[model samples]
Target: MVSSFHVDARALALVGSHATCETEHVPETRRRVVAVVGPTAAGKTALSVALCQRIGGEVVNGDAVQLFRGMDIGSAKAEPAERAGVPHHLLDVLDVTQEANVAEFQRDARAAIDAVRSRGATPVLVGGSSLYVRAVLDPLDFPGTDPAVRARWSAELESRGPEALHAVLEERDPQAAAQILPSNGRRIVRALEVVELTGRPFTAAMPGYRSVYDDLVMIGLSVPRDVLDARIEKRVAQMWADGFVEEVRTLRAQGLERSMTASRALGYQQVLAYLRGEIGEHEAIAQTTAGTRKFARRQERMFRKDPRISWLDVDDHALVERAVALASSA
Candidate 1:
């Protein structure tokens, strides 16, 4: 990605000094970068579109799951009609069989942001994935992976199942084990890999409050837990009604089961379990709702720790107006 701005000694001398400029300057000529973040069903998409409409901004997707094509219904991707003519970037950049790497995503998202700004448009990064958002806007780095160690873990995962591997993680790194779900075999393996190579806990290398960019504006949508739960259940019902099962069925026929990344997505995983006769349709819907509620709680917990974000109630009537005011001030 290109630098957002260039600093020159001559310009610094004219402004007083580098220290003074760092303390009090926000160049009006610099392009704005804003992020809309929150839990699932908190109306982030609508809020982002409204912000873009007001500020002449373009949307840059920050969700990891929304990167894949043919995984739309489960990912809750923004339909073209819902985007309100705003040019959205990076919606379907990968196929279902492709694995998503955060390092690659950081590079791609930054390029998209630069492209948006090059056209004199604000880049509004919107999604619920905490790590993806941080990877774009924060100074986060992925640890190097050893192919031999990774292959060993992968073979163990294939033979013994995720639960068995999770047990191993619990013995080695309890804190990392607590954060990752037992069923998340991919993450569990990665965490163990990091522990072996770096000689440190996996959580120690995670992103903190250190941001890579200056003048970044983060707005978080806040909702009551009960209301958010109701919204998630309603959204899951709507997804099912929209033939999400059929969408997964189509992808399954095209090697979804062998696709490690796409197969582990929320709705698709549950529906796949139902299709395999591991669970019924009713059980699938119920489990999806329960899992979504849990995921929302985790999202809230994650975002609350970021001190840079300004939180607003999603139910407020003046949400858009307040967000516009915040962006204008930035």
Candidate 2:
């Protein structure tokens, strides 16, 4: 049986016809910025493409990992064909060695949105990166980084480990520490840097949920936990079958490990460990699956806190129709 997540021919036709009759008539000034957000493997990509087709929109990538070059399969970045002729921005725009800065992404994404609007197309932001998505849509201010402070935290993380630094974060800002994983040394270091630089709790630096844009439509794909877990396992299996390990091997030679951000990506980290003989291939794949499941849960929880999102079941047969209606009405 075909999964409901797949956009069938009939649905595409309906969306295409709707685009011609309705969305095409809407003025560019009135165009709404549509954001397709959800947990991993919840079919956000398919929905984003379909919605763009129905709304004369361009996709602005909101996923952090997809920004890096050569980190394709594991990021589940849409292939050119999968994009269905829609222009996609921000994918493969950075080298793996460079860390993804959410503050920079906020500026870039808003610029992309403006550029799309200038060309008379709506901007459709799609990804599972909750913070990146929020950075683009919300009025969030990122604290400036002090190189000395950041370097000190980085040194502390390297010497004492992520957990030790995370413990310090717990003492300084329990809310920030609770939100960040103990194993995520980079994020821990960043949080610590922010705390030290601002002389305030890291969590206090974050803004409340409020969008800068008046016309914004946030569509969140909702998948049941059991189904999402199964989908994550299947996705990891597919990644392995699609040369994910080889991709990691190729990137490893390209200095993926030297990258503070890319090296720690879910599958890449596990596969690197496997290549280093720290774990077996089977264990690597297993860990990737388990880690991705946990990450998806976290994504869902973060997105759930925002009341602006219009949640739709991923399995809904009229998913595209409903999404089109939401965007059109906006």
Candidate 3:
């Protein structure tokens, strides 16, 4: 039986039609940007590397968490040795104390893609961050913000907690609230800010299936739920064994707890809880695995909403070759 997560035939047709339309309208010299996307632990990195080797591409980091300078083991960032001499952009762009803004990332990523193309290399975007990837590919715009209004929401989030603020968001924009996690206070605050600023639903700011890039091809990796669950468990176990706790400890000393964005990443959050004596070590590991599984589902759901992606199973032996062919044709 096919999983609901699989891309439909209509999506495949849309991708084909869009590629043809792009070719006709876009300048012949414009380059195509290839996005390798999937749920966590689905081998997006491996596939991206293979594609790069085949097409002489450079990698553009698409995962939000991997932007931090020192977050290695937890974010599964490709080490210098693992990158195998392929140049990577935006891997260590932010300090742990700094925040990651989607609008800024969009601008930086576009410039990186341009730079790669100028050097006669294909730009391959690889990561599990669904919105970040869309931010690069789609014509999405960020709403303007007032510090005072944002501060007020942040205060409310601190005093009343994220759940309470989320309740208010639910009352104002249920659709947006449904998509933003209650624990994700940073995004909740931003959503409320946009609603107040524009007097519109936060979801209204999201662009449709229109591509900002002249030529863009999105390849999604599909994995069975059971297999992905096992992968998540094993990945989390390896992270712990690789001293993820020690990595977090180093970051915490550098003010990771004070950062709004970096502090809330999957494994880092659970490890912080464990460090605070809120949970046991084993519980932290279990929670990380569970949270990752939940995050994987959200990633799949986000990508599935876009009708332009070509989904392929990760277990297929010819997966790399197939992605290369599709991307080249696109």
- For each candidate in the order shown, give its overall lDDT on alpha carbons: 0.82, 0.82, 0.81
**Which digits, one per residue and each the tens of the lDDT, describe model 3 over residues 163-201?**
999999999999999887777889999999999989999
**What is the number of backbone collisions in each predicted candidate, taken in the order shown?**
0, 0, 0
Q: What is the lDDT for 24 in model 1?
A: 18
Give all TM-scores, in the order shown.
Answer: 0.89, 0.91, 0.89
Off by over 4 Å in 3: 1-30
Please give, for residues 68-164, the per-residue lDDT of candidate 2 as tens digits: 8899999998887777777777777777667777787788778778877777788899988777888898888898878888888889888999889
Q: What is the lDDT of residue 133 in candidate 3?
A: 89
Candidate with the larger TM-score of 1 and 3: 3
Angstrom error of the Cα, residue 308, model 3: value is 1.0
Q: How would you encode candidate 1's per-residue C-alpha lDDT over 1-330 as one tens digit per residue? A: 222111123211111111111111323423889999999899999999888777767788888788777888998998877777776777766667677777777877887788777777678899897888998999878898999999999999999999999999999899888777787788899999999999998878776697776868999999999999999999999999999999999999888887677798888889999999999999999988998889889888889989999999998999998998777684
The numbered model that scores best in TM-score is: 2
Using lDDT, rank the candidates from best to worst: 2, 1, 3
